[model samples]
Target: MDFNFIGTIWSLLPPVVAIALALKTKEVYSSLFIGIVLGAILFCLSMGTGFDGFLSHLLNDTVGEGDDAKSYGLIHCLSDPWNVGILVFLVVLGSIVSLMNKAGGSAAFGRWAAKHIKSKIGAQVATIILGILIFIDDYFNCLTVGSVMRPITVRYGVTKEKLAYLIDSTAAPVCIISPISSWAAAVSGFVSGGENGLALFCQAIPFNFYAFFTIIFMLMIVVTGFDFKAMSKYDERLKEWYERNGWQLDEVSDTKLQIVEHGVGAKADSKKPKETKGAVADLVVPIIMLIVFCMTGMVYSGGYFDATSANYHDFVDSFAASNASVGLVIGSLTALILTIMMFVVKKTLKFDDAMSCLIKGFEAMVPAVLILTLAWTLKSMTDSLGAAEYVSGVVASSAAGLQMLLPAIVFIVAACLAFATGTSWGTFGILIPICIAVFPVAAPLRIISISACMAGAVCGDHISPISDTTIMASAGAECKHVHHVSSQLPYALTVAGVSFLTFVVAGLTQGMGLMASAAISWISGIILLIVALTILKRIKCKKE
Candidate 1:
């Protein structure tokens, strides 16, 4: 149904009410659902329909209607190739993680890390490196890194809040920078016209200040052991309450902590983690194989080796046309099989145990998957209300002759939309097109403006409680959801502040072309992060 509402701003209501309710209630699912309901209501009202019409539309979106029903509503969203692929990918990856944990790979890895790491800084740094290494997808990165590193970090007295932040900081940030990733596929699909989506995305990387600087800022925060406000309380409280007292985390948090600390799941021997038999290879091999297989899967789906395709000889050309969702599922499924066999053959875990992990894995991912689906549905609702078109119109209208200011403006627009909607891809679908339309495809400003859209979306996702990445990060770290969001906001905003200035610099220097502007803006952003962190550290010292 037509939901334009005669050009009114009511299209913005769903996300606005949802974000407000989420923050105020420290809840995500209900808030998002409520927002979805509100948007459906708005859509109905705009069409001059009533509750019955709303139910009919909801049914059409969620379930099947007659042949008159379009194939692109809420229900159809679940069947969308991209959406289904991601869901299956999450399930498979979760199962692989579960299998590893059940077979003592994770516990064994933690024991090994504790011996070699020897310090808190080393533990945190190891987590960062591992997080960066898992640049396949943000969902995979968050869960795998969190589960593998949680035990090790806990040993070093690193707070769950801090670990959650680290997992989150690395997830969307690292994935966005990776050329072969699910995120790359999503970003690639958003841009229209010349240079191809992947090429444009690659060109825009240098201008993506928020992402690269988040990594930098995250490193500095960990290396310096900086803590402030709620983070400080949680860090010190946990350090004193659990680590200092030698109390189990069971005394500190909820059941999820039990799962993370004890490695819960059938055949997961929580009995003696110290005696958990495994080598560093048990941990390293599966991860490496997963990466390799996933990459292979991606390239394969892109038809890299398909001789029939004209671009078969060129890997980059193939990958630019790849389907991220398909490749991830294929790779993760392959990795899961190989990992299970390795565990069973080694007697690290039984075949039966591996079989049980399948269910456990799916169970673990249920929360992330459910949240993602709801987020998607909410996006659907807003989309039905024409939010993207409205926002795009506003941006295009205001963007004339303001080339230098456009990047920052796009950044703000993208950030607000992502924050309220809690979905980066949704923001991308809205803003990237507007950016390309406003600045000619050949203009340096086009690349900068597009990068701002991406960077802003990531920034918003980093902090928003309702963002799937944020929720997954919390699940991975076993931190309370709201705790993760609230604790990470200050840190995210700090990097975002510096990123805004860097975008301004980039926009100003666009005439110098990609490499020059990228270098200048990136270096400036790093300096800004260092200076900002230094000042904050000094202020903390003075307060102490």
Candidate 2:
């Protein structure tokens, strides 16, 4: 596809406006809304619309396009199935999230977790594990994990900024690595159609530098208790709030150790905390059901089961026929309804309180929903304008000896595109086919290249402020979006840099032992950690 400079420029304007507004205003929803409106305006201008026509086009694009050329100016771009699907998923997910919160499931989980998990690092670790556990869907994983883990982390003086970073890092990074995750499904589908898809995926795992390293980096941060410069600012702010308000940390501390040691005083209540029977069961069973149903759905959709002497295709045809979204929607709704019933039946919450919880959950998700809409709108605008394709084409064309540095090139290109689009899946979709077509014969290089694409996509998606994961992370931490972005950038870049270097070495060596490469990556990470720790110590010393 040929590039349209004007279209590209116009398409790029939205994110630029978002970034500018975000930086200047630090109001995430406002920034995203402005970006969406700006994109609509640019779309109108591109179509040569007048002010009235532009307004009409904006409505048409947001709603649906009609057959009229004037209507075409407004709605043609967003009429695509993918765009519509994205919008539906975002809104529905928002509703689901709200329901989960409203049912007191999230609060119950948080309160329950806080009782068991002690120490700041443990809370962060729990957040990461929860993020990893909810791997079936990144959107679900990011928001659900963040919502459940935030209050516990906040109680321990674990800054929301840090919590957001942990949530963001684990969400996409863990999803890409898990075979059954939405991210893996998308990439696997792409590779399956290509030569030796399974082999390519396996080989790519070793070179998924970003995902591997980011996870390690998160763990290191958790273990070492080192805060980045921006994160220190958050820490200071949190401390100031505590000091000025004369908030007694001991009074609010809810950890099991604290409660066991201090008894009633630990809970900020003199009365014994009421234990609802099956409180844990209420949380655990629904999650288990969601997983079982989703896996069964995937298997059914993929046609993996056939008791009769059915052919493989027949099995796949029957089992794998349903959309994944249907499974998620059904699973989330079932879980939410069941949780509500469980709470009500046990008298853990009255019906009215249960309803109130659901409303609060939905309200908590308002920011995420708005940001998601704008992000999707930005994505639609870019895709329609061919911004990603144009940029990919430019990178593919301009790079010298792409065959030699295919892995590195893939990493850079995928990272840039994913960052631009705020979607790893979209980046994978765009780049995987191109990689497969270009590197048809070189199996090792193909694996490496595709892996690089996945890694880069995850890396960029994890770090990009406009990414749904990033937004959800901020919401999870209850931190400012810019604060999360600023605090997390240094850590993300640290991993990105190390991953890039590892990719270079891996590409040059052409599939050197995975252990050796992992060791090298680990050694580099240790060095980064030591340096970070040293710097943090110096800062601490200076502060004291």
Candidate 3:
């Protein structure tokens, strides 16, 4: 409850060390190892431990158990329910993705998509839409959408760099807006006890300036077919590759191509591309089932249909009250089972291949699994140090006219924290408690402040180079991570600037009116479109 300055400062040491190591080594795994070790060292020092005791304690805490040898600080932080859920979700999702990949589902979808999409811009738009649709999990959004979209985008001359931007933009941005998403579940769990969590989320949506505008910005780029200076640099490289290789470079590499071709050959060898019976059904049926089961599960978990079918809103209300994760787990399991059945019935996959596909799907998730584990560890360490609470206290105490600028300050704080943590959900988790507790003292301003925090978290996560969504975006596009970071930064910054301005004006005018704020956002979106177009024309001129 109270600030522990020394404890907080010491707590920050691990993440700082981790970042420094990452930069120095340019190896993500090594950097995470350094971070974990640094965190353990600090924990040991704080708890008065010898090196051996420290090692024992660290191992115990890392693997989710703690004994008398370990400090309570280490145990409680590591065993947080949210943390446990996140870790499980990451591992399971990874397994599912590996399965999808192994079944040739992803490649089949990609090849089919590529043959139809003719232009670079169209492919980018398709990628964006797919990103939006896969809102259940950001990790899923990134890998599946990216893997499926990558081949198509490549065939149409869209730079991998641009594809990364689109994928990253859509992942967290869309998830934060949807109330049923895993991201929302995490955020709501933090802020849901007394307050109307759903309403709070809906209120935040209008002012979620970064997410609102990022979508607009992406659409602008797609519609105007414009590339910024940084993006243009990457696009030029792609064009050069195409000119020399005669679009051969546009095709998938021989290894991936071979996999797809072999799968095709097994089905039918050059004799008329017979629409694999229920190929569309193979894809569509399972997805529809996923949605239906997920919704039904949510209703059951939330207690939405409790022996009465009076009205639709009440039914929805019942669903909201149910346990969401139960629904998610059930839905995901059903989808997985149905997918296997579809493969068998359609002859789309053999029993051995299907089993192999599942293994491969889990295998592909290894990197994600590792990254998630490290990320959670880092988050636990930070929480144990009490960094977020300390900062929240400082802001609550020091700021002037706190009521008036509460929203803007929340936004700024959330953004800064998210940037530091490279996680929007973590940022939201850290700030929501503080916002809920502090904002009520200011009455109406509480709404604005809470909204600001949500918006800020989204903005920060959108741009953070270390963010999982950002990494996924790059992976999805097959672009260098740095390239995605560099190309996307300017656009993200531009939106942030405008969002800040809008928040300031809204605060000053006491205009937290949703329609007005939305109108301003729309106008701002249009201006961004014009600017993107102008920039694209300039790039064209330079090329000519």
Candidate 4:
């Protein structure tokens, strides 16, 4: 028999095993590798191949010498041009960050912020605002916001867990809703069948309940001083430690510095100079230049600057066709070169000192790079096993009988898929096409359902322990990965629950005009979220 697990229930095992083991063991690398091996084994069994087949599926790529030829596995993922570009961008960005720190730009900014930002609330709010302002890409937002706000937040006694949550809450949520972002470009690329993808994405933004509500929920958390029990425990521990040590609120002690610098890839004690002639401009100029060059690179890659290319178009159109990986690599490399020159020229760092940051930066990003590589490989495993096919088939089968409840159902399915695979872009690639296939172009429910897909994907990505964004946020804030995941879950779920209900309302009211339906559902979502938070706060108060 020609055996295969393609589009079957068994295809889900690899990612399921990966997610389950990661959550239980709290060890990502081995868990992901194990899942990859299992998936390869499954593929071998399905193909009726022997040990060689397993080896090929695990570490090698196939070029189709026969009918059974396929392309997947870890080696293939590492060799992929897109993945390499992302890796390059990460390394370059890491070098830039290290240079900034070595030149004392970060410390200067920290001192500047501490002097001006008076309260804990102000620091937290500033973090959120900065996160929101960097809406071009989530990866960029996570690292930038973390580096910029970490010192200020620490100075105010905000827990690392809390800072990670703030960075994460704004990252994907903001990008998913912003029309000028890399996320919009990704989403637009999926709109097939002669549809205007960018326009559709804009129309759907108003209905992205999860993304919008998450931002609101974060602000509410900051304003109301509300913390979920998991997060509160972290807060309480920090408070007790401070009390025990008699540490002043504003003091940046060596002990605290060690805590902030721990496990996030950098050794703060060795690399940073005691004194340097660095100012806020050293930090601010590079970041601003990075943004400018990155945006230009994205548009250029999309052919906006290439009049001879067939894809040549205006800024938005070009960006829609742009390659994020390529653009980021190009932009970050340019920014790194410029930043090095700036630091060296200003005498903040010697040429040799600036050059040394490249190594330090690479070292700092090793943890993130390893996690990302494994995550990508794990995703490759699921691809080999046909997990996306299985999920899509299931969704297609279930769509026939449930019209009004469809949006909510889609949201749940998308969330589960993203949570399992730990890839929001992959989730979008899977579900958004299915959504377009299920509903007519003119159908009111089409927009709502598409919005649900995006919301659900972001929701899952936000909470998934293995998600790259989650990993980046932890790395950015210098928090333990497990601590960030465990602390952020309750808050993400709270918003997710409200989002699900909102999707239900949106699905039911699809007969109404788009504006009316969005307004009604949005208002209902706000009320429900506020009520849920109030009740939860009371419960927390009672527990205290």
Q: State TM-scores per candidate.
A: 0.90, 0.81, 0.81, 0.95
Error of 4 at 109 (Å): 0.7
Cα shift from native, residue 128, model 2 (Å): 1.9
Residue pairs in collision within model 3: 98-361, 99-361, 301-322, 301-323, 302-321, 302-322, 304-318, 304-319, 407-449
- After the best TM-score superposition of candidate 4, give how far the Cα of residue 532 lies from its true spot, in angstroms: 0.8
lDDT of 3 by residue, 1-544 (tens): 2323334655666666765665556566677666666666666666566888566645554322556232323345346554454444444444455555555555566666767775667788888888888776676577667766766676666677787888888888888887766666566667765766766776667667677778887797688766678888877775674555444544654343433333322232334332333333444455566567766766665655556644333543544364555666666677777778777766767877767766665565566556656655665566555566766766677445566666777778788777666778777776787777775533555566667788898888887656777766765555666667778888787777767766665565455565665566556645755675576588678886
For each candidate in the order shown, give its overall lDDT on alpha carbons: 0.80, 0.66, 0.65, 0.87
lDDT by residue (tens digit), candidate 2, 267-354:
4445544444334455556567656666555555454554453533342333223345554655555666666677677776678876
Candidate scoring better on lDDT of 1 and 2:
1
lDDT accuracy of residue 436 in candidate 2: 76
For model 2, the stretches where C-alpha displacement exceeds 4 angstroms are: 1-10, 41-53, 61-116, 192-199, 244-278, 300-322, 350-357, 399-402, 511-544
Off by over 4 Å in 3: 1-10, 20-24, 61-108, 228-233, 248-278, 295-326, 441-443, 471-487, 511-544
**Candidate 4 local accuracy as lDDT?**
0.87
Which 10 consecutive residues of model 4 have the lowest summed lDDT? Answer: 263-272
Model 1 lDDT tens row, 280-391 = 7777788888889888888888888789867573676556677878887888889988998888888888898889999999998888888788777887777777777777
Positional deviation of residue 289's Cα in model 1 after best superposition, in angstroms: 2.0
By TM-score, highest first, what's the ranking?
4, 1, 2, 3
